[model samples]
Target: MTNALTFFEPTRTAGLERLRNFAPDAGRHYGERRNYLGTAKNPGAVSALSPYLRTGLVSQSEVLRTVLDQHSAKDADRYIAEVLWRSYWQGWLALRPSVWDAYQADLKRLHNAVQTQSGLRQRWENACLGQTGIAPFDAWANELAHSGYLHNHARMWFASIWVHTLELPWQLGADFFLRHLLDGCPASNTLGWKWVAGIQTIGKPYLATQENIEKFTEGRFAKVPGLATQAAPIPAPPHPDRMPLWNTGQPDPALHSGLILHEDNLNPTHVLDAAGPIAGHVTVMATADQTPWQMAPHVQAFRGQAAQNMQNLLADRIGPAGPAVTSALALKQWAQDHGFAQLVTADAPVGPTKALFDAYDRLPDAPPLVRMRAPLDADAWPLATAGFFKFRKHIPALLARLS
Candidate 1:
């Protein structure tokens, strides 16, 4: 959309009012025009709910349930299918954890290689700065840098340019997006770049053609030079020797509990059962400092919002909000000081957060750590053992259950 404001902003009531109000109509309307990009002055077509969904501001099931409550299963089928897309991606990545490892390796290799190649580095710089001669692609590059959001369709085209035209490593492209996009995700972002590189899908990679970009962008941008005339199949990297599966040991509900909020998954209300009294709440954010901290402004703002929400929610159960801290040591100290016997957090899918927590040697003698996987993901992971098509087959049944 011309206007970059998302449904996740405070001016939009941060999606609570909009979600509650538009859910009934969301099924039919969203299914029909959800892909349309509109300006900031008016963003009526799409739900504008990705940021909230990215975070746990609204639960995935709650959105599905609300849509089902309004529209019939038959009527809401398309909208319901869209909701499951995220679940499918997450499940697919979980099964193929090697994807995450290979991405990190490729990122490091490309970052180092590009530093030595002046020509390649210049092209990468131009693409990132939106100075590339490709009009539509350049516009999208600038949009992502400035807005931290892009329509899904635009994302595909932009990725195609970075990989094919600029000839940069796909992992670098994915890293650039993660460092920028507000809804920047480990699974979706990495997996998406792989798909465009012809690794996620067997042999078919998305190539950005001038005609397609012109048609989809509503004639906004037409001239994209040096476009890849044909697609090249990039063989998928061999899966890692073994994937690290999360240990699912439920902790006692009665322990003096504290919640640790990370970017892994934002919604805790669903996973963190209020079965017993919750003692205190502590919110934590790990800065994605893997690349240059270009998105520091947005990151700082999001951290503040996350801590504020956690503080507000815990005010009734606990007294005042605990301090929002950045360091793991500081967070652990807070947990220890508060006398928490158990720490609750969402399952880290795969990325820096997962890597950080995986390093047990660097951690303190913390409380019992509990990671909760969403019920949606719990159901979808089994289907994800194979391929996206097999995963796609479950979409109907998945929607039926959610409905």
Candidate 2:
């Protein structure tokens, strides 16, 4: 039931086909009613594309391109904006890496503090186990545990409840979500948790209430008692000076290409297409300091499958990297042994994979790293330098550029 296995079901194929079929309708409908959680009896009108997109079965560009082809710019604008939100979060976190560091530091501090406070630990454990004694919150908690899915609104309210009402550390709550949610993303998860705690927006923490929950849930959840209102105020981490984009160097058709698969870029077949003639391809997934807790068995199995799929795809071109290696020292050793002077991969933005590449990128004699930026991100990230409004203004031009 992990996110990985949840996809690849017949349901996922149907879901992708649904996106292709009703995209126009979905886009237009989502434009107007994206925020409305229809009823407990019916899920919201949102296209549940995250699981597929997360696994690289469908690219974001493909999804957006398909929608735009079916609907007018005027009608599909809101849906497009929603898609760009992922880009905004990624770019925002990338430019301000300190926010991530601060989150890690605060999470460590809070985790230690929670160990000393039995009352807080018990509440947190209860929250994790969906035993918080609050009907709506408990329901969502169980939903996440059982189904690995939560409606967008439910996630916000759940996060708000954990941070404000329960008086728990926001990072712990965010980590809990990241570990459980099928679409648990680094940028979205980190920024989202910060947003709930008032750190991302500066003094504007989200607060959940029985009234709002009932309103959104269409009265599916009505009675809940004993929720706190105050969220711990976390200061916005100071923005880091924008680092100039490192020259990935020119793509050399003559050089052999090696591959590194990170969570950010789960699929490499697309890059292999662009890599021209390759002497060899080595698929590597280094989960070395990836502490997302015990990953579900399905997740582990899916990674194995993905690696096999990648290897099968590249069988004619080259060989796959053997076993999962979790050390920088070993990575360098492998790179040297393979005689690959250039490593081409799908770009990993602002995540552990990116961090690993950053370390490798700095190595004096390391191979040339050519990370292919997805068309969607390459177009959207520059717009993200400012606010969403400014970024929204570029949509027409952006889509036009794509065409």
Candidate 3:
């Protein structure tokens, strides 16, 4: 892939333009050739709209609506399914948030393991640095490190190698991608690695064979060797019982409130429409809260700048805009000092931003927090009670509602 910085602009304007340009291809063309891996300069038939979609710059509903305007639902079935896969992953994690907690605990344990186990540390470093003897795996590691993006097919192949072939801990592999990928999200990245490891689906592990890689890469990579042929399911506890979805609260029109913007949802048009006026505005940077270790410099820089970009976009609506704050305490104090009765923000799904809000809500003397979820999420999340196939049965009806 080419330099990620060159392709992704990390702004709402850039995201919408990219969506417009890609709308025409979100049909048969996408279904036919989306799997072929092309160089970063070309990127094959894929939309490459993930960085924007991941941050809610261009929402899933907006993307689907734009594509449906150009093509029928049947024609765009594959493309639409791919987009909703993100929603499925999110809703799945939201209900079973314990999985995320377990991942964090496991990551801390492995981090300590790397400190004491010299050989393990060296092997982990080599895989991350793309120095492992496997040619295709090494190339992908280099591509990810350089571009901060990878073809979806390539991500699966890389994860398979990391888990089954290289025999490295899956959490470390997930962390490596989270540190670099411009589109990385907690729910998707964590569950995706779990899915590849056969834990998410329970015994349906995805193995990347040499033949499949050679075929998918269109002969760019052939003669690869030393891949694991068979995969056994990773041991894991059964899925936790589903929790009731949280209800989005409306901003009280009578109370003085402050609108808070974060990377999870840059466009707060719905929130502005719901809340009559704002007393003050603040932006929170929660990228640091995504992981215990320091986030990659590029990841930190992108999120901070994205929040700034959002502030500039909503300047007219944001009265008394303040600088970005990083902690839950800082956010609580900011709201209190601004004399806000309630703090309103776009409801972040299960991720780092949500984690931050969870902390803020627990703080004593914290201002009331009003989290307003988007109409799309409100409609789609509840349907994800089971696997994607079961949830997928409702796509046509969901698309009809959007119309």
Candidate 4:
């Protein structure tokens, strides 16, 4: 377990292969060993299919269906819930996108504070540089910076320590993850940090203790001292009112169409089917917009390579890809260059990709950009009106639809 975790190849083929290899252990074996962090060489039973899942490289339903084929839902329930947790977070945030808005606002203020305030800047710098003198925390910080992946259990522990012991702003900690983790998404990363800080559940905060860390990590971090002894909830406003979930947008088949690809949904089979034959496709990356600070090299490389791989995959259907762009203006140029009457893509959830499209929407007389949400997302997202416990009630129904 001493080895830093190794990342898998950033491609759909690599993702499916990982799923196939992990399928056998997706039931009791996974549930039993899932919490243990066994490093790169040793590796635990967890799937590590997140980078793939984070994008649309491999899907929730597809991952779940593969596991269910090998094991019954009764046995694989834990792993099943793990996969759907992403969907649950996305749904919760989509229902109340203002949560993301507020988080962004907080980050803007904090980002400037770090730049202008010396004491705050030093503390934050030490934490991000993995020089905090807390052995385990420093190791994890470096690991996240180097490898674009982390164990879910480790992330919870890290977030807890970041908010409680360090007493740093939770939004800043979330930004750190967004700047690094390949699986970083607006909902999961932000909501997760909030949950650790006790804001999401409102009064129930996750705290990291030396005893818990030592036990879960198999003494890899034994006697890790100087963690927060108590966790007090971070004060926050009430949850935003639930807005109606967005339905899948139907693309007009009669129009000359083009496809747009982003890190949000690279392998956009569903969108392509909806748009009919695309005259061309263009890949756009917005990972840079996800964080205020410079992103980690690993995050950029992983997402960039994955987008290119998917574009190569759909090249036959969508034709050669235009030069990948990062801004709304370039996106408009793609539409104008091809002179397609319409452009369509997979609906980006609330995050950087959405921000790019939001900017695009402001441009004068731009071609209509139809975004198609997946049947799985459109079905399951609305059900997250309450807590995950409430959402679990709909799993069987959702799985039934997947079949």
Q: Once model 2 is optimally superposed onto the true structure by TM-score, how far is the C-alpha of residue 399 displaced, in angstroms?
A: 1.4
Q: Summarize candidate 3's per-residue lDDT along 211-292 as a digit string, tens digits.
A: 9999999898898988999875577888889988776799997889899888778777889999978878888778676666
Order of all candidates by lDDT, from best down to worst? Answer: 4, 3, 2, 1
lDDT of 1 by residue, 1-403 (tens): 3223332462224656767776766767777766555422344565556666766666678888787778887787777776777777777777767677777777777788788999888987898888987777777787776666778778888899888777777877887788777677778888888889887775778988887777766677666667988776565655444344566446477777877666655556644664246676666566454453354356446545755665565467543346765566776788789988877767666666566555522585876667777667777766766666677777767766764
- Give residue 130's lDDT in candidate 4 (0 to 100): 90
What lDDT is reached at residue 285 by model 3? Answer: 74
Cα-based TM-score, every candidate: 0.87, 0.87, 0.97, 0.96
Model 1, C-alpha of 38: deviation from truth (Å): 4.2
- Looking at model 1, the pairs that clash are 3-40, 56-267
RMSD versus native structure for model 2: 3.1
The lowest-lDDT stretch of 10 consecutive residues in candidate 3 is 1-10
> What is the Å distance of residue 167 in model 3 from its true position?
1.1
Clashes of each: 2, 0, 2, 0
- Candidate 2: worst 10 consecutive residues by lDDT? 3-12
Q: Alpha carbon lDDT of residue 371, candidate 2?
A: 81
- Write down the lDDT of every candidate, Cα atoms only: 0.68, 0.68, 0.85, 0.86
